[model samples]
Target chain A: MTYFAGIDVGSLSTEAVIIDEDATMLGYSIQETGADPVRAATEALREALSLVGVSREQLHHVVATGYGRINIPFADRKITEISCHAMGAHHLFPDTGTVIDIGGQDSKVIRINAEGRVLDFTMNDKCAAGTGRFLEVMAGTFGVPVQELGELSLKAQKEIPISSVCTVFAESEVISLIAQNRPREQIIRGLHRAVVSRVWGMAQSVGIEGAVTMSGGVAKNRGIVALFEENLGHSIHIHSEPQIIGALGAALLARGEIHQK
Target chain B: MHITRKEYLLEQKEKGRRLMGVFPALYPREILWALDIVPAEIWDPPLEIRQAGAHLQPYICSVVRLGLELILQGKCDFLDGFLFPHTCDSIQNLASVIYDFIGARKPCYFFYHPKIPHGHTARDYYLKNLKALAAELKRQFGPLKMDSLREKVDMGRRISELLGELYDLRAARRLDASNEAFYRTIRKGEYLFPDDYIAELEGFLTQTRSEESRNGATIILSGILPNPPQILTLLDDLDVQVGHDDLLNGSRRLLISNEKPGDPFEYMAECYFHMPPCPTRGSSISDRMRHLLSLINATGAKGVIFNVVKFCEPEWFDVPNLQEELKKRGVPSLVLDTELNQGLSGQMKTRLEAFIEIVRVHRESITTKH
Candidate 1:
């Protein structure tokens, strides 16, 4: 009963997943990456092993992904989240041909083929305009938890426009809106719209193909998906647990690598 | 292939060669060569900026700031004079600061290359500027000999032909060298005299296919000089091969011609106009797009990386449009804003890794489909 494992050490969080020979999920774990990716990656791998009631020696292969993929010294191989996300999304939705992944620090739009390989992709990584960090900054102004901004936006009515896409300028705009006694929900909605607008430009550049799927932590935010779907003029498919997609993809890829051996 | 700048200058001086500091972009080095002057091209001077900030606008590029800083610190005092070729607004400003404002101790010369595409009178206009620059050199140094200029022009043509051969080999994927070594080899043209540069290039090209071909996504790195050098080390680390380049301070500034069939002055003018479309020269966006796409097709690159220097207005002006055009053609590209002499950021590294992943996946996707 050989099992493959994957550890994804991201900027904001680290995740780990395990899959059996049949490609069935066993268990997974998620933890804050904090300031050190190496330690967080180890902890994530341990969590995955412990949750599945197995030792590190039980894993047939290990694949690492995310920003800290190279930092995981013990991993057998490292892969990029761009391919991981596409592979993960396609596994969940076989018909999915496009993936829109918005993470803590960047946004990426990937075009995937039926074989779960990446056809093309674009990213906005140089600036924090259309990233999760942008919304986190806005959430700080409203004194709301980053995890709760999605629910708050659902209650938005009389939605106001947040013009600036720059995080600094958008933060000031949010602060000024708060100062004006504007509704917090409306500001949250506007921030979501700003992010959607920025990410939409990249999505259009890649030219959407078949059914679109959304991945990454941002996909967990219903408000962002709803706004992005509206702009895309189609409903987006999201995994039941979207945040673990990259790790799941890595585990899947690890399985393939082992079989080839 | 190997000579220290100090050693090269000493060797040249022993041969009665005087040196002049030349700023970035188009300049007729042949004129200086005819006068027994070695134009030491200055693109990105890796030095701490202590005094240039007070003189330059905050929005000016680091390339300009560093070049100006080198002069302000008198680090370039060993040179006989300076030549400023109007490359961009930032360079134009730097020229004013050094030549017209700070009032350099040595003689100063300027060349205003035509910004727009060639017109009916463009050739004559370029020749006039060349003669004017020659007149200036005649005052500072000895008079330029017409016969010597013709020989220098032939020297320039040979250099261009050799560079073109190197490029064509790179495009055909026959040159077997790492991206860093290739660029470093090409950039040696900046300091080496024509005699040494041609011999060294010929030798380097002969040894290119000895190693195994790089196993990674092919990329075109377009922008300013591949400064910070760490980017190349990182490319080596990531296994990404730079198959071709549109680097303004590097291959983009190379004379892309082998034609010296007749008049030397007219041949020089033809080489200038025959240059591959560049953003700084105010060439049409579509023209640059066509050139880049052809390079991609020629080199089989999976993606294009625009390594734009921050505050480089000429590049920034043309990037978005060029990116849009490339996108329409289904070509993936990345824009990286960099500062010279600075280390690559962690975020930048992640982005680049992600991009390589994209290219790799894309290649797999295409291959799987076929």
Candidate 2:
């Protein structure tokens, strides 16, 4: 009955997961990060704890991950989402070699080995063009829920190109297309194409190795996934709850610490 | 110990020594040292940048902004003049803005090193440039005596060799000094007189070797210059030893051992060309990659931390390509964009911690594998 908890407080959303000593996932929670990271993280942790009928005091350890990992006061450890994503993806897909994590703040391509150790990695250098934030900003302009961008884009008949690599410039391009009375579906397709293109450049930079796995909330975008797979020239393994993989990884790490002790 | 660097310069000036503000990259400090002129190397002045933002474009690097700010605020009025070496467009623009636009009282000295060596005249042209600078110094200060020039050249060589030894000791993981102590001790040359600076370095070398474990994660920092203090402190806090650096301020100048057997100008020219390939010098990406990898292997460094200056076009052009090369070689690196004197941000601390954790994990995994 010894349970471990992990929480990931990302810029756009927060997620928490719980696991038992046996490494079996017990429960998880996902919610918008909101303005207050502490509140968002605590609420998500409480929800995950409640799902397993466990109180906060019952947890053996609590590990935090993601951009706001350092802000989590109750956590026993703070692990980078880069490391957590690699760990989480490898946990679900043990054959994973390369893990592409496109998150709200930054995008990273990490090369993991057969044993789930990161070989080498690179992150988008202080630029927002190739990240989840880019899409979120685009979604706001389109008056669409960020989650529906993938599904909505899949309906495009003829995709137009969105050429700007910069987010602000691309937003202007999106506006011009909107003025030109272009179909929403086609524009969404172009936007997805742009995100995938940018992320693909990062993936190529790290170079593909073994079976690729996708992590972070962007993995929820079915259209972006399709584009990534198309450019990556292979199938990708994504967890059922893609957004919570980092949390799951953190929980697993927490369990490992317990066993060591 | 308590006097500010500026105060030290004023003291030297009051003693009738000429003080010149030297800008970034590839200046023959020996020339000034020979002339009894204290070249106050101005990379990053620890002044609050209030008015610099109004004049400089937001896209310009902080080095240019702060350097220009130091002059614009009239803090550098004590300086006899400023020497702008051919470094980057930002620095070149700053020179023009100060000389051509501001029309400041003190004369500005410019040394244009040929970007590409074309023929036999390349060395001659460089020698001419060096002699022209000397001639300019004579017109302003006095005649350059050969004996004083040779003595200062000797001093410069001694200092370079001492620094080179320090670098070697650190690379071998035998240096007892902390990261801050090591860099701060080396950078004392920025303001300290050669005799005093060399004495301090000599003092440091007495405790050079130690039986300390080299097992901690070692990294090479590549950048234009090191500053803001906190990053060095953080590296030490993380138990990460900076084994060696390819920084403009660090090994770039000290890399060429001062063993050039020739006249002063030729020796200086040799040192200039032999500086470990800088992108500002128009070195190809491949050359930079080779030099970086060599440092990595030599130091047993686990990774490289590219502490690039923000908006530095010269460094930026080479970083992505160099990073790609590192990735291809399966070497890990973290690229950071930093401004001068802007202390480490909270997010930056987390990132540094994560990078260190990654190195830790990678090390543990390696040992476990064996």
Candidate 3:
């Protein structure tokens, strides 16, 4: 059985997905990127391969992606996360024509054609306000885990408005709101709204195409997804492990590379 | 074989050539050359913003800020005069600050080339401005002899002809030069004496033009200047060639096509009107879009990259509409907001790579269909 692997080394975390010739995903692993991308990518790929009881030598092809993709010495190919997300999202949800990926430090809205090829894409320009890092910093300011903020925001009776689009200024605003004894859930929901508001502008630039798919680590946040859905006036499709989508796409691309040869 | 701009200017000064520090966008260089003054364009000068910040607002672009800083730093002490073209509001305000507030010891000349309505009145106004500028330059430096002006105008035409050929070669994929090398050769015209610049361009054309076409993803660059040249170097690394450009400091200023060359002053005015549509020149959005599409069609470029300088109001205003137009036409475009002289960030690199990937995909789809 021929095996293929894709590793995505992102700013906050690294993920690896293993698949076979048939493009069926067999196993995956996600881990913090920390300071060493090479080590993270290696360990993630090893863990993913182990999950499927496969050896590194058995893999026919390997593709690397994300911010630290250039750091991977063993990658047969390095594709950008933009194209990977589009292909991965379309593969899972065949009807998907648009993809919204809010990663650690950047957020991008990609418009894909019927063949899962990227038609157009727009990303936040050197700003973290519309990205997952913004939510993580806000969660830290609230002294809550990043993962819990989403669920906590769902309980908000009324969301206080977050007017600052800058991450630094927004953090200070959250601090001031906490000082004013504002409801924590309300503030959390407001932060989510800020993120959605920022990304909505990008989505509008590319103009959402057909059914939208949400990928990247932030897509796992139920509150953010719910806010995006409300903003779009339609539900978005999200994979159970959304963070692995980039790697899955890379893996599929790797499999395609072999066929092309 | 190549010397720095400062070094070349110093050599020319030693050779007794008077240098006029020229500001951005449109200007009558033939007049300057005719008056025995070399125009050293002052766009994107490499300088830290210390004294300039105290004078100009933070909202001002780096092109103006760096120009101010270059002057405030006393780097233009060797310059004989300054010419401020009416390109944009910030540059206009910077000229006022230099002439009125800072009291530049050197003579300051302002040329308000007519924007929009490039009709009879605009031409008459441009011709009048050209004569006024020549008169002012004569009073400051020397006399504007007619024969000298005629010869310089011819030289200007020759330079433009050569530039057009060079651009045609690149668009046709016959130029075997990297993006960095091509821009480096073209930007020499900013400071070098026209004769010297023409020689350098000829040498580059002879050396780099190839019978065999080069292979790579071709794209057009639209911007004020390709500063932080690391972007070009990055494109070189990625095997992406800048097939053509509409940059203010580049084709917008250099690619002057003049059919009516009967008189020197009239030819200069005609050249100004014939420049590629630029927002700084008050070019209409539709005109700029048509020009961009024409370039893409001529070069067979799969994408357009708007490498805008940060805080540039003129470029900032036109980008959204231009990008929308390109999108509607099925050409992928990327907007990169960059500061002058700053290194390319990792995020910017990723964005550029991703855009190239999309362009490659577009190329493949077209190829498969054909």
Candidate 4:
């Protein structure tokens, strides 16, 4: 079976996925971006290839996506993260009309047409306060592992309000709340609420359509996903491994490239 | 002393020097100088009250519209080339339209500077831009002499030093000239020869120290690039002296010191980095706002006028935040949208007059109680 390879070298992580001619996922891998993106991407690709038992010669085409996509010299074609996210979200759930992606450093809300084409999108790259980095910092302050934040926050008795949207100021506010003996769960919930509020602001800018699909690493945070659902006043459909959506989209695009050739 | 720009153009034509007009601060001045072209800034569009509306949309920023109006009127006939930088999206699209439609005769060159700030990658990108610009200049204007480029750089450095001193004097309120006169002097210096303009500024500075003002409200004007003269003229007409301004044309371009100048390209990148950044330059709106506020307090200004260009996203995002911050400090601010018309001067004057009157009444009440 001929296989297509897709690599997504994101700011915080690297993901690779392999798919067959019929768009069946053969194998996929995700790893943290340690120091060098080139090394991380290579490692992720190797891991994915080992899982599928496929050699490099079996690959029909290679596609890359995300901020570090340009650095991947081996990729045959590079696509924008916005386009990839929209395609991936549409592929997972055909009814998804909007995609809200909150990554490590950037947040984007894309409006997709019925044909899964990105009609328009808006990105907030200038701030890290509403992204995954924001949640990571808040989790660190509360002495909670970042992975456990979402589950613990769901147990909060009351929703506490976080007034500061800035990451640095919010960290100080979290410390002050701790000194005041505020419950860690409530504060974490409030942190999620704040992040959702900021993302909602961006979503409103692009006129967010319903049937929104949440993608990127932040989608794994159940606290943030719940907050986003509440703030947006609609249910959000998330992928099993949301971070791999970009790679999946890239692989699908590579499949299309082979057909065109 | 009172030569019209038309007359100056005629003289340049006689001397066979190609006059190329550029706008605002970040244009590649060194390249133009090396090409032996006279770099003139369209600080104010020479509008005749009739043709402003047909050429520019009222919703657009006046400075940009005025620039368009100037090109439409054929006032730029003497120019051989125009260099537009990717400052804002509005100006970028404007440059595109002018290059395709309006700027028919003059060859227009545009540069896309990366929007990222304070990152090593961005700095390296800026250095790459310098080399690219140098190569473009060589292709367009033949090979340039290193000695001549160094000479021009030194000339620009000296002029910047003089401009910085002028800003210092204005900040201290030691210069006795009206805000309009001071702004015009600087505007003229930007238009004329650097060394000659410095000599003229030195003469004016020496003469102005002894004079005194009877009544004027010290105010700070904050904006992206206040190159047009109408805003300053309106402030002057309303008896409001601009104690400090944070626009690119005013203080942002003047803050670069020439102390460490070795490689010209490196110097250009360093200057771009160290120059007082505009709100549009990065994500640090709070830092820029704080810097402007500190300058305002240092100058003892009573109010601020945020002259924002309409439809300019960066400035639009910044103004509301700055206004809220300034209000927390009990400082009142007025945002005026720039339109490319001579009539805007009157409207601006009325706004300034009202703002200054409020400041006066506020001050009087405190003085009476004291």
Highest lDDT: give the candidate number: 3
Worst 10 residues of 2 chain A by lDDT: A117-126
lDDT of 1 by residue, A45-155 (tens): 898899899899989999999888887988899888888888888888999999998888888888888878877777875778988888778888788888899888888
Could you give the CAPRI-style class of model 1?
acceptable
- CA lDDT, candidate 4, residue A193: 87
Native-contact fraction for each model?
A: 0.57, 0.35, 0.61, 0.00
DockQ for the candidates, in order: 0.45, 0.34, 0.71, 0.01
TM-score of each: 0.89, 0.88, 0.97, 0.54
Number of clashes recorded per candidate: 0, 0, 0, 2
Find the 10 residues in a row with the least total lDDT in model 1 chain B: B209-218
lDDT (Cα, tens digit) per residue for candidate 1, span B87-175: 88788778888877898888888898888757857677788998899998988898888899898888888888888888877777778
Clashing pairs in model 3, backbone N/Cα/C closer than 3 A: none
Computed on alpha carbons, the lDDT of every model, listed in order, comes to 0.84, 0.84, 0.90, 0.75
Candidate 2 structure quality by residue, lDDT tens digits, B1-370: 4577888899999988999998987787888877889989889887788887876788998888889889988999999999999888888888988899887689789988877533456667788899999989888888799888888888888888889889988999888878999988888888777887888788889876676746588889999887767889999977789989989888877737446646888787776677788877777887888899899889988778889889989889889888878867767788778988998765576567667777787666667899
Candidate 4 at B27: error in angstroms?
1.8
Report model 3's interface C-alpha RMSD after superposition on the true interface residues.
1.0
lDDT of 3 by residue, B1-370 (tens): 4678888888888988899999987788888888778899998887888899999888888999999999999999999999999988998999999999999998999998887737898889889988898888888788889999999888888889889999999999999998999998888888877788889989999999999988878999999889889999988988999989989888887646648577877778778888888888789999999999999999999999999999999899999999888878889999999999988887888888889989998998899999
TM for candidate 1 is: 0.89
Give the Å shift of residue A97 in candidate 3: 1.3
A1-261: candidate 4 lDDT, tens digit per residue: 889988988878999999999988888999897679888888999999999999988898998887777688789987667777777888888898999988887787877767566655666644577888888888888888888999988999887899987999999999999999998899888888888888888777557785999899999989889888887777899988999988988888789779967
CA deviation > 4 Å runs, candidate 1? A137-141, A160-165, A169-182, A259-261, B1-16, B116-120, B209-217, B256-262, B285-290, B324-330, B362-370
